[model samples]
Target: MMITMKQNSRAPNAITSLDVYLNSLKVGVIVRTPGDFSAFSLNESYRQTGGHPVLSLSLRAASGGLRKDPKPVSKTVPAFFANLLPEDKLREAMEKHHAEAVRPGNDFDLLAALGADLPGAIRVVPSEGSLAVQPVREEGKGKARFSLAGVQMKLSVMKNTGKGGGLTLPLDDNDGQYIAKFPSTAFPGVSENEFANLALAEAISMEVPERELVEKSDFAGIPEDFDTMSDGKVLLIRRFDRDEGHSRIHIEDMAQVFGIYPARKYDGAAYHDIASALNVAISPSAALEFVRRLTLAVITGNGDMHLKNWSLIYRGDGNTPALSPVYDLLSTVPYIPADGMALSLGGERSFKALTADRWKAFAHRARMPEPAVLRAVTDTVALVNENWWQLPERAHVPDRVLDRIDAHIKTLTPILTSCANS
Candidate 1:
């Protein structure tokens, strides 16, 4: 069902409609109708070329036939587009700085303001008969041009500076290659804790992105207000979705792939669901990696591996997607004493309650071989026990933070020990 757009003279200059492009190919159009309702329809040309739907299963023909149609997605903001927008306080700041007066349904305005250098290969620009794409800003040096999603207050930056040393903010529409995460004002020493946890994951042979500790003094372009509160140290996480040339690689989180809203990220989803989705949408090996990461999370006291935390990356090919590198991993138990697992595993959320039998059941539900599942879990336990102790020092985590995490890890030692012996 191809719907060709006829030019409307009443279109607003603030982007009442947008043309969605995936890597230079026009995939669809997002339009805001009367009563502030919004809808996205896939272009007929994209469907004819056998291109993958931007929203996957959520935006497909209802008849289950070979002919694809442009369906009006129920979500006012598509999952793929929603995932790119900032969340919580960051979103509030963005709204205030850009278009504070825009109504709730005017997501196109927000996209037009911050869509230039977003994650993945998706680009949203104004459609014909609507406003033209916003002009590029000529801001002062050190001003950030790009925006990052999620609730955390972080900055996208380029770590490589030739003769001039220090971090460079992605100003002037520069696509950054690294994410510089600062210590949270509420959670002290979070940067060190995450660095330590990520180091431990890498030590256990997990496929993690390259990361390092960056001192504030060594970095330029840090906002003065942030510099005042920060501990002069930040975790520099390499962007797994970007190549060496800083080009965008397609990646979608579990929420996007499953068509679940970000609010329900922790609820209505389980580990088995993630595994099953990976097995169907990607490969069995990707599902196995999910299990390995889950095992690591349990041993490391990480209680925040929610749907948004896990992602699948497309490797230049249009047909296949693989599990992306592990990210947003850290021990939340130390900061929040009552924190629990974000999603259930084998119908259980408590790490201490996860037994071998439950893991086998989870494997069965995920359609994985039971024996291979057990081996992965047991081997991960052994690996963590062998390498976890040396990571805090190597990562330069503070003594107090290390002590808290160590205490929590000790509580789970019995469980790990039992699994290993079993």
Candidate 2:
């Protein structure tokens, strides 16, 4: 079934609206309505435009044109649009910082303010007024054109841009190349944990972006208040959505693909669904990549690999899609010992779900080629076995956390049972 939205038939009047553009092509208009999310309508020209990248999998029809479902988002905007804005304290911080231009707790206003530099190649500017210029909180300091999702304390900064230039705040003209993640007081050593996880993922031949941990002292141009929020060291991950020339490369997550809101990201979807969609819309290789990445999450005890965590990248071409470079790799069992997988697979969400029986069942249920799926799992497990202990990034991981990861890995290695026979 195609993903569909129901729009309210309210009398058109003086309501605020935002122009949604993907790579300079006007895709649609979202009008603020008395609903959970604003109402949206696809632009007719965009519908006629050939070679435009798929905005969201939910919006496309089987005939290769925009679905004429008529209305979009009766209670809320499309999940794809909603996912563009930040969430939790980070979103609150953005609203607080831009309170001068927009209403508090208003997502529509927040999108208008932060839309210029959101994730992916999309831009949501006010159809009526000029795009909001970031208000300088500190005298003579450039405010970062900042708008990244997630609850982490992250600052978008341009790292080593010009001759002898170090870390600096990114502007509209000069967008950030890397996301500088700071230490979380609630989740201590998160940067270290991710660093170690990335290194381990690389060992298994996963495609991850360039990443490193940097001292807070090396950071420059961070807003005065944000600098205070940081601890000693930070993790910097290069953005994959932007190219060398800093143009936009489109991206979308499973939540958008499933046509569900972000709040329900962990629910109403599963790893099986993601793999199935990738195989159908993209290629078998992309589905295989998903298998390996989820295996990375499973062995590492990463319980936070929710729908939004997995994504698809479009390299400016409209139809072709691939799994984006791996990111947000965290070892969460140290913080929450009883945690489990974010999405269910083969009727299981626990660490013990990686059984040989479950792997075969998962492939059969997802309609994927069983042999290839099993190989992806066995390859991931084998690579982790061969290279995990000696990972150089282990130096960043604490001994306690490292021990926990090792313990988790041991539990999953036994899934190599039928793997050898496969």
Clashing pairs in 1: none
Give per-residue CA lDDT, model 2, range 87-188, as digits (tens).
777776666666555566566667766677888888776675444554334555544456787777787788775777678767644578788888877777
Best candidate, TM-score: 2
Query: Model 2 reaches what TM-score against the true structure?
Result: 0.89
Candidate 2 local lDDT, residue 382:
84
Worst 10 residues of 2 by lDDT: 3-12
Q: For candidate 2, what is the lDDT?
A: 0.76
- TM-score of decoy 1: 0.86
lDDT of 1 by residue, 1-422 (tens): 22234443221235667787776667888876665556777787777766664435344444632334334454356665776777776666555444333333345556765665677766666676343322332354333435577877677788656786678666535688888887777777888888888888888878889998877776776554234464657889999878988667877788877677666788958999999888876778878878888988887789889988988777766446778889998888778777778898888888778887678778888889887777788788778878887655445766677777887777876775565544
Off by over 4 Å in 1: 1-13, 52-76, 99-106, 129-145, 160-162, 222-228, 392-395, 420-422
Per-model lDDT: 0.71, 0.76
Q: In model 2, how large is the Cα lDDT of residue 97?
A: 65
